[model samples]
Target: MPTGPALRIDLFLLAGLFPGLTHAAALGAAVDYAVAAERAGFDGVWLAEHHFSAYGTCPSAVVLAGHLLGRTDRLRVGTAAAILPNRHPIALAEETALLDAVSGGRFDLGVARGGPWVDLEVFGTGLDRYGHDGFAAALDLLLAGLSGAGTVAGDRHRFPFREVAMVPVAERGLPVWVAATGSSTVGLAAARGLPLLLGMHDDDAAKAAMLHGYARAGTGTPRAGHASTHLALVADTVEEAEAALRRTMPAWLAAAGGSERIDGSAPPRRDAGAYLEHLLAIHPVGPPARCVRRLAATVSTTGVRRLLLMVEGAGERRRTLANIERLGREVLAPLRRLH
Candidate 1:
């Protein structure tokens, strides 16, 4: 058996409002999945944030994280990310501290420099805030407010406060995971001694390259363990799993559409079929043994101790619940022994 750090498997909730499902039901399903994940012995649940789109219904990842933290005693609840570009860092930091206090430190705060989508305009952050400088300013304040004696000040993006004290401080000082898809974001996170939340679309080799980039950008010592997300499903056979994904995922992806630009220009429509094919080829969307091997390879190649699995692509509550249970019993159990 391979000996190393223990594997921590988590469920990644996108809160997708699938076809024929009402918004209420979609959100409800996310809650149900989190509860089931805990019972199935999964280590944690990470919520995705999106706004003004059916691709994902949850606008506030922190709010859902707090609720799930209340729902499960031992399961760690986190944001796969809260979109920093659309939020005030101080406000997000306060919520992070509050959730930390209430959940007894079971909350993880992962943030991302989201794209130049309409969310920026709607949140009043503007299109300029989509730039790296804007994201860095916001992240600086967030980090300071979480780690300092409640005094955070920044003049960038029209946000400047002088020595304001943030109450209900998280005494434990929670680690913030930066979601990175490119070198700019990876370097930003690495410079501050932060961990990364890598995306699912990238293969193990690509993800390994990103990890190497982080090492090159940062000091020698790594501060926190990084996390990697992968689309996952489990069935008796590969054909069954692939067929189920084919039947449901394309609709969900198509519904997701393209990121709306603020300047009234339509973004290019993503080929849902091609993307789905890519994910099936690269991800662990198969039987238990196959999933175990793929996930183990991910850990070995990227050296990421945390794995967030997207097992809800089938868009059916019953099927997702069964997938979670099977993952725990078959895939996660076997992987845990090896690591």
Candidate 2:
């Protein structure tokens, strides 16, 4: 369990891609937000990966990290998750290593087994074969390769050498994070002593159950981290913030494949009211003082060592960025002082 002081906060680039925003615009916003987060005393900024979908534009998070690295001075840039199956271990290792080197070792790697059947089908990658066992194997190889202990080789690709090391290894090992959505994956990550990055779509009970299972399987007091993301807009009035959330919630939930439905309802179905309830359940959305109180409560209840704020929803980019700035200045700052 996390002890003493509140968990470190990070600003997540949740709205990496949207219908109105172009890929270049999204990337630019991400880079700009990285600088903003650093200036606002954030611990890091995380970019997500998605493919062939307007939900997110970042098909290659490593490349995005490289761009962000050149733009920011002290901020640690990382992928909220890079889908492992879409990438070869050696290539992934090399790309991450290069980014780490360029950023002067300010890189964290978060990988997931993959998400959404549509994405997997588009990539021609089958989740049938790349389930738990394959994920563990790939993770083992990825970690070993990243840590400079293993050689990568196969019929299609090879890093051929007796004891070749992955280049640009961090002075300390890069923190490898596993994005776990299910209990089994959470347990696997914990049992393997890896940090877990819980996604935003999970409900309170589901999240708590996953974390509890993780604790049960975790060994030797390993550190745990998680991020609860939703449409956050901290205005002077809760009504204004809620109104913004209402506008963005439907589209945002739709893009997430309508997974926010938790009332025994089938997914991919949009109900504005249900979605708003779902968003309120997961995110800290309100006025600044209220937002701070809510966030602190979430941290205490969840036992997550990190909190990631996603001020950007499927709303206007400029408005979202302005909200992010206000959140950092008003909400997070006071929370930090309280802690």
Candidate 3:
């Protein structure tokens, strides 16, 4: 068993349109995953947002969360992130407030400074808002709106508005997490006393550094717990786990090729095989014992309590369900004993 604190395991749903599945089918599988996760005794489920791509089908994470919230009673549903650059701050705040009220505060709002994707043009937020300054401005407006301030204004992008009180204001500052991939964004989130949502690609050391940076920049104490994502799977053997991932992830990664920057400068395409190897090497993808070891290392090294595991690497819905069952029974059960 792990020598560290027990984990609060949650499932990370990409709502991915894997090979041989329609958009509707992919969404159906996501719903099943959420319901199954709650039944499996997961703490929560986070939904990822992607637009105009087969890599992920869910365009609006907030909307998906609303549907999932109605489907389950005890499960906490959140946007892995709702893209901050793609929508107005007030509109997003209002939606978050409504969901928080209806769900009895089971709803979490995690926002990302989305890339320079075509989503910016489609949403008419422009490419400028994809930068650091713009994201800071947008985040500021969002905080004000959620904090029950009578009026809100923007600094750099200058989205100024008159004195307008937010209706159905959050009883307290609603739970908010900012997705941070770099030190700059981590510092931005920290200065405001907001917890971060770290991605899966980074290793334990890198994640630890980000957390340390946030601690240094922010107030002595954090407002809420920070969250991190990881690639996870549970099977009978290491080879079996690797085989399942090798069979499915290549196609999904291939579909996710090419950055969607509107500036007409496309980054080089990714090599699926190489990337998959890197992910397997970094994450936990073996049997229950091995999975526990890797996860415990993360908790010990980074001091993070919440982990969102991506278990859909097996592609098929039945296999994904089986993975969840095994993880809950074989992995989570043992880890729970550690606490």
Q: Report the CA-based lDDT of candidate 3 relative to the real structure.
A: 0.87
How much lDDT does candidate 1 score? Answer: 0.89
Model 3 steric clash total: 0
TM-score of each: 0.97, 0.85, 0.95
The best candidate by TM-score is: 1
Model 3 misplacement above 4 A: 1-6, 150-157
C-alpha local distance difference test of each model: 0.89, 0.70, 0.87
Candidate 1 residue 34 C-alpha distance from true site, Å: 0.3
Model 2 lDDT-worst window of ten: 152-161
Candidate 1's residue-wise lDDT over 38-72, tens digit each? 99999999999988888899999999998899889
Model 3 agreement with the true structure over 1-339: per-residue lDDT tens digits: 444444678999998888889999999999999999999999899999999989889999999999999999999998889999999998999899899999988898899997888889988999778888888888888998888655555543358566666877876877679999998999899989998999987999999999999999998656668888999999889999999999999889887875477877785688998899988998889989999888878887898888899999989999999989888889887766653
Estimate, for each residue in 1-339, the C-alpha lDDT of model 2 and write its tens digit: 335746577877854565567778877777777787777678788878877656676788878888877888887788878888766666788787778777788877888887434544555655642577767767776777676543444332222334555565544555578888787788778877888787766655666677788878988445435555444668887777778777765665566563222233465555757866777766677778888887766666676657777766636777776876787788877777655
Question: What is the alpha-carbon RMSD of candidate 2 to the true structure?
Answer: 4.5
Candidate numbers, best TM-score first, in rank order: 1, 3, 2
Total clashing pairs for each candidate: 0, 0, 0
The deviation in Å at residue 142 for candidate 2 is 0.8
| Descending-lDDT candidate ranking | 1, 3, 2
Better of 1 and 3 by TM-score: 1
